[model samples]
Target: MKKKRHLKKEAKIFLIGLGLLIFIIIVILIIPKKEKVLMPLFVGLKKEDAIEFCKLNNCKVDISYEYNIDFEKDEIIKQNKEKNSELKDNEKIEIVISKGINYQVYSDNNVNELGRIPVMMYHGIIDKKSEETSYTGGNVDKDGYQRTYEAFINDLEFYYKSGYRMIRLADYINGKIDCELGKSPIVLTFDDGLSNSIKVTGLDEKGNIIIDPHSAVGILESFKKKYPDFKVTATFFLNGGLFNQKEYNDKIIDWMIKNGYDIGNHTYSHADLTTTTEEETIKEVGRMYKLLKSKTNKFVNIVALPYGTPYKSTHANFKHVLSGTYEGESYQTDCTLRVGWESDYSPFSESFNPQFVKRIRAYDNDGNDFDITYNFKYLETRRYISDGNPNTVVVKNENVEKVTPTNLKIIGY
Candidate 1:
């Protein structure tokens, strides 16, 4: 009887052990295994940019290490998975970052390759006294402003008359065709959509705005009439916040697109993008891109810095990228192209250097005088005559003293 009882106990123990082993195996198979995914790291991205990247990749991040970057800090150096890999949900994605470099030293020696490109800027048309007197920085005198219109017509007329073809910015960048050097290869651009851009109060008999147009449509229409074949186009960098406001301008942006012109990105609120906080900077720059993208389904990669200056700390003597919220402030050191004025277009002088860019202000009726390059010369001569010092002396009862005029210049005649 005792031996039989011991055998029963052994059998029960064996069964219990077998049941536990089966349960363990089932548990192992039931739980799902996680899959691996790819996270790409660009050469010049920061921690914030990483986060944005993660957001794009579905909230999976596992940073691995950092590298020393002499030029840009917090930039991404590497990623865990190689490019074009399928990442599973919740899988860890490791990436490497870089320690930044001194921006000031870089700016002094650094140059932007794209800076070779020339850009022309302009304010409003000098139409009213209130508008003409409003010319502050880079003053486009009323007559000189008018000459820009005349120059446009003349440029189109010349192009049409001479059979010179016009091309867009992308055409030059993509190397569509080699330009004939010293043969007047140029890019025409304007900044800020002012009210004067649409008005046509001072146009010539050729239906050209002797004064600059106050509207976008007006400018395009005028250009179309004069040089339909040359395909004259201008880039209008917009302040997204100001588009619908009563004081802000641009009723013709849509018209320009429908009529075959391109639009580029300008910061959201026209803030000095260099000094703004990372979040705000991202919001500002990103917002404009988003707005334009949503409306036009177009991607805008070009940017024009407001105030045409870099952040105080950015040390941007020329143009450089700021730390973006999406991509830390990695200045585009490789770029060389920046936009500015080529010359003072008002008075005709042989002293103009096209390399040194000049901007214009188009406002009032007087701007009509500057409708053509020759018109520019005429206005300059007139300005010289009006501003020339007259040799008139005040007679005093006491001993007379020799006096010179405050605005005197050498008399030629």
Candidate 2:
């Protein structure tokens, strides 16, 4: 009897141990596991790299950008979590990105913040004089669409002396003006992408292109050297021909973009949008955009309308010009240009509509009817003068109502 009792006790102990092992397994399966990882060093990395790391590590990321001098733009300047710190996979981390010394300040008090800005439009820049051509007196065509090389130089001098600094058309449309204090922002745009605009001659010994010194790009580079603070830049609206240099087209485009110039869509064939159906319009705009993207990744989503057709947005195919898809790829533009004759409103103004931006004809007409001279004279008291602070829009007390509601702080004096 004693021997039987001993065996029962041993079996009871074995069953209890098995039940405990099963209970432990069940508990482990039911309870959630706490997963953790050490935060990697994120500071000094590019913002994109840090975000990508977070995306793979199952961590949440918050980012903010600020003007930083020490760090390059888009580089991570700071991080909330330290390197090697234990963090739950779901924890959030905040990072600050550098905007690369984009801040400026000035104490001038005479800025006219609620005024118009000039978007100057130019075409072919020929190395000819009036005596060489049977056109008007100035170095321009009779219609003034083309300006002589000498006349173009004179125009640059006029703009610099008149306190106008060059800004990209894209920046102006986006309201990101970055000129000096008391200076007005001026946008330079060249249409047609003519040979004279950027003529690439034979390559040099170093295989670098030899741009004709009198070409539009050559003159602008020389002027930029003379007036470094002018921030001399222009947007060249190009068709598929691309400055008409079939062999050196890609090289010229790459050079322009690397040198801080902008390229925009002028349609694949310079198709007049008003004459085309909706599908045709999309193809024209989209094909040019796609072609540019294929050449360089830095495609500016702005189009200079061919002949400035469909001048209003009410046209049936106008929306297609703004955004559309062609052959499976989609394209969108932020603003459209007209063969305009006057200055456009300040982007901060309630009257500003990026859908249709006007431009001034950069030609000589004896100061007549919306030409360069006439427009500058008209803008003397009505120019959008910089307040030296891009984060705020300061205007006269009477113009407060004209300020557009924005995230930017609005102040009226």
List the global CA lDDT of all models: 0.44, 0.87
Candidate 1 lDDT, 1-413, residue by residue in tens: 99999999999999999999999999889988755545554556676776776786676676655434332567677776777677766566777777543233323422111112223344443433332443422234633333234333434455445323344443333323223311222345455544455443443575433333534445556767765555666655666743343422233444456555656566678777557765666676667666666556433355556665452333542222332333332222111123333223211122322222243233223334323333333333221111101221111212122222222221111
**Tens digit of lDDT per residue, candidate 2, span 166-253?**
9988888888888787899999999988989889888999888889988999999999999999998999999988889998888899
Instruction: State every prediction's TM-score relative to the real structure.
Output: 0.41, 0.74
User: Best lDDT goes to which candidate?
Assistant: 2
RMSD per model, one decimal: 22.7, 12.2
Q: Which candidate is the best by TM-score?
A: 2
**What lDDT is reached at residue 150 by model 2?**
80
TM value for model 2: 0.74
Clash totals, every prediction: 48, 0
Off by over 4 Å in 2: 1-109, 137-139
